[model samples]
Target: MAELRLEELTAQTIVAARNLALKPGQAAFIAPETYVHVEQDLDPAGSWPRVVMDGDHLVGYVMGAFDADATEDFLKAALWRVHVEADAQGAGVGRFAVQALADEARRRGFDRLTVVWASGEAGPEEFFKAVGFEVVGETPYGENLGALAL
Candidate 1:
């Protein structure tokens, strides 16, 4: 029962969480591609969100960004590069993190939030469904786009 908190991801924490992600086979993360943009993204919109700390240990990371530029009336949000350390995976931390992100999205007046999970990693799809996301579509190589109305 670890209580979760949302914190900006420091460069150090990004590396730590990246290391954690790399250790697990088949659990690849988009972080390797997008982490460099964190500070800039956070600065502009205050929404390159990350979650940190499980009693002072960094257990995971998530980034949520809005797609206001899209023509769709509902504000689009993307939940990216999310991964929890192996030991913390089944301990409810992921769910808590999702809830936190959803809370943030709602606060920001987003109409919907989407989690694009790397495919064949059905665990996340199940996790998303558990927390109220509906499958909108799939991406190549089995990645999925799941959405939740805020």
Candidate 2:
């Protein structure tokens, strides 16, 4: 496994983050410019947009929020989006990224980290479960909701 690190999104890295790609058919799991658009709407006090790196390479992207009101009553933080470049998938980057996000949530006084993924996506379902997130419910649009108690 490569050494994975999560760094706060900076202007220099934002372009690389936007260019991170998913494998074909995996785009349905997340929108193509989510990082770009979400950054524009971030509330600095509660949202964290990070660029996931493997040494010097930009390999993934993640955005999470600690906005209590934006999540369900039981959640204290939410992992909004996570994407690993197709070449980096299955090499532990995603696991490292999610764990880093969970650590951030804990540091922010959150006891749980929640996430939602397209319901029918086998990859995300398995990935979340492998990282200790249990199926909690479903979203209005039919996304599978999962939560990890920190």
Number of the top TM-score candidate = 2
Model 2 stretches astray by more than 4 angstroms:
31-44, 121-123
Q: For candidate 1, lDDT tens digit of each residue in 18-48? A: 6875344545444323333332443246357
Residues 22-131, candidate 2: write the lDDT tens digits.
88878777732333333444456877889888889999998887776642442348787888999999998889889999998998888989876765543577888999
> Residue 75 error for model 2, in Å?
6.5
CA RMSD per model (angstroms): 4.3, 3.6
TM-scores, all models, native as reference: 0.74, 0.84
lDDT of 2 at 87: 95
Clashing pairs for predicted structure model 2, backbone only: none
Candidate 1 deviant stretches above 4 angstroms: 21-23, 29-47, 71-75, 121-123, 139-142
lDDT of 1: 0.66
